[model samples]
Target: MKIYLLYTGGTVGSVGKPLGPLAGPRFVDAFRANVETIITSQLPGTTINYDYFTPTLDSTNMQPADWVRIAQKVLSNYKKNDAFLVLHGTDTMAWTSSALSFLLPGISKPLFVTGSQLPLFFEQDESYTLLFNTDALRNVLGAIQFMTFAIPEVALYFADTLYRGNRVIKSNAREFTAFSSSNYPALGRYGVLPVLNERLVRPAPSTNALNNHIQKVAADLNIIMENINRSSVIQFLLFPAYYDRTSGDSLIVSMLTQLSRVNPPLRGIVFESFGEGNIPDFASMQALLMDLSTSGIILVDCTQVYAGDVNYGAYATGAWLKGAGVISGYDMTPVAALAKLVIQLARDPSSPKDEIQKAMSTDLAGEMVIL
Candidate 1:
């Protein structure tokens, strides 16, 4: 068995009082010296290869360009390795995983992203000591073990569960179980043995078609990277109205008005609307959104609630958003919706507004449940 372990500095590769990431090469050396033995002993004959991003970034500092870099690396080495594992920061790991799923559609091998809430190693008397009780090693080992099963999709492994990459969200900051895939079931669960829920895994594409798709993606890699770097997509969380009765417009409407006029113009918006995708029925709000849609800004209505679909037709207050050209991001986490928009826009910047909206409404990577 062969695995490509790409480390993009995270809590899993850090040590010390302040919890900062270690230099990539240094972390690689430390892992080989301290942890490789355990892995090698358990998974005998497995050959693990290591790579890292130069001057590793904290997950909070992760950007769209970084997602492209990760995708490129995986694609470039797709044939050489049997499985891929990404050591990412918990903060934005879900975003990276979600983006990768779109960037590498129909991936036929296991790709797992995992990170720890606490540093993988700790300083004890001026020397490094492995923290056995920490979630870092457990998660890493779990991912490595699960890789042998060849689950064919981009997935995130943490807290003893494997989830569809785009279906997950970072729901907790302090717990080992930091991610939640509330709308989807675990692809696999870890106990004494890894038990995969085979029904939930995406069926692998045929070898020839998978290779052809990858070749096409590789051909357009540069354009995709450039588009992603220049892409302008933002998420807005709608709140209760604070109205200025004299003006008859809420502050939310005023803010949207300003946002609509930004330089270079806004390309897309992932509006985190209230329960079941309802937004205030103010006239000003509806007018500005319609104008923005008319002006070619893609609007995706996503639910702020953690575990429900955005059924625009379910409520009168929400139905107007659809009439104004807003599309439903049914059950997608805000992160997934945001990343999907960015990727779709980058993939086809010149595409018409309805085309982009259609892409958003479609489940390209199991990110949403379209009802």
Candidate 2:
């Protein structure tokens, strides 16, 4: 079996020496020599191919477009390899992995993504040296088939636990245990024997080749957090437990009012609602939110809760909000919803205001729950 190692710049591939507080290590010829030596010595008979990105990048510099590139690279190589391994930077690994799972729909091979906390060039550890070897990976291939890879979807493997990418959030900046999937458990543990957790993995879809089955169409999603331009599109980040507070109410109004004043009028608003879709029933809050919806801005009732389905209009308060023009957000996360809204808004600024309502409810990137 041939394993292709696609290296996109990250700490794992970075080589630089510190110069006081601002200095970074440079990737010298010795760095490559060390890596090659370790691979050659540890995996005696295995064949491994290495490719570097045009220009290495720090994990902080990662974007969705970068993910598109990585996915394309894998798709391009689907015919020649039995399985693939990606050495990625941990910073945005979860986001990239999640995007890949969506972009590459029917992946059938072991597309394992791993990287060390310390660069192989800078560190000296048995784990990094041993794990980087083809032998370390070859031993696990007998049991890692298409079905096993599907479980936990595209996962982030670090510090022992393997977590589903979409569910994982970056919780640390310096530690090896940087990624965590709080809503879900590790898909499987990696130790003496990698235990397969069938329940967590999704069954493979019907497809001839994993590469050709991907949805090549990429979404033009935007993640608006601080940049609320004078554009007609606006979304409010609402936490359920705090939606009742005067502060939350004010934020909602400020965002709505600001958008309404923009040229061509605002398109919609995504209310990042709290747990299982509950919101404050205060008349002031209801009127303010409903007024924007009635005025043609889409009001998406997204849940702030990390897990579970959002039951919009389930309670009297929820029903009142829904009746007043709020659409159930279902189970979309704030980041996903915001991105979806940006995509929709960009496609058609004058989109039948109902588009936001619809997109937020749909399961794009497996980021939302249908039920």
Candidate 3:
């Protein structure tokens, strides 16, 4: 089978140090040198085609433009390949995968985003030297096999678990299982062999006409247009856990004041509020939010808690904020909430404001977990 591999440098391709993750000089060649035996010996006849970003940046420094590049890259070669695999950094891999879910809804082929917390080529000790990690190499190889199953929706595969892309999150930094899909079950799991829970997987649209329609919608977004920008959304997270009475209100006031001053106004917002969706109730916070909402900023909230969906009227503290046009993000990850908003806002033919709101609330890509 043929697959398109996108290598946006990260721990996956590194040997060690400052030049390691960035693909400085000839890191790709070095990485291939390390894993060539396994790729050829175990995964015998698979034809893998790869593309490396011109100047790969650490995922920590991953930007909005990077997401656009990734989407465009996939679209450019969508018809030529049977499947796609993205070798991304663990740091912002979930964020990129989440963005891709909205960017390519009803995707026709299996698209898997995979990475290693411990570098697959090699690792580092106290002196910043290369120490090869075979376990990571195994994980990468295992994931490659899984991608051939024709899984339709975008998903992230790591640590023996394949999760819905938008549902997954990077929950750990130092552990082998560095990711989690708290709100949704994994689409597949790997043991001696891959076990796919097809019931959980969203099937691709059966008709090619439907598939082409979806692809055309995405293609329209990539066309360059004057006075238009795709990255026209913002996000805010209200940290109730670390706030005092005075700081909370004052902080909210300052943040709102700054948001109002942004020129041309934002298209949408991912407002991450407290447990079960509770935003601050200070008079200034309420007033400013109402103004932004009326200004047509589509504000939506996901919870800071790991498990529950957002329930707006559970308490009085945040009830007033609802009237300000805040929509619940249900059980979506923060990255998903933001990415989806940016996507619908940028949709071509100028997706109506109400239609965008309706789309966000609906489960277009198995992102929403209805309770």
Regions of candidate 2 where Cα sits further than 4 Å from its true position: 15-32, 36-46, 115-118, 123-153, 213-236, 239-249, 259-271, 279-302, 305-309, 313-321, 324-369
> Which is the leading candidate under lDDT?
1
Comparison by TM-score, 2 against 3, better one:
3
lDDT of 1: 0.87
lDDT of 3 by residue, 56-144 (tens): 76788787667777877887878788888888888889888998877765587888888787766543342232344534666677778
The models' CA-based lDDT, in order, is: 0.87, 0.57, 0.74
Q: Least accurate stretch of 10 residues (summed lDDT) in model 1?
A: 205-214
For candidate 1, write residues 1-371 as lDDT tens digits. 78888999989988776777878888888788778888999999888899999989789899888998999998888888899999999999999999999888768899899989987787666466788899999999999898888878999999999999999989999788899988999999999998999999988877633456767888666678978766578899999869764566688988887887775458988999999999887777778888888988899989988889898778899989888988888899889999889888888789987788888888887888788
- Clashing pairs for model 1 are none
Candidate whose TM-score is highest: 1
- TM-score, prediction 2: 0.66
**Residue pairs clashing, model 2:** 15-25, 16-25, 16-26, 17-25, 151-201, 232-266, 240-274, 268-298
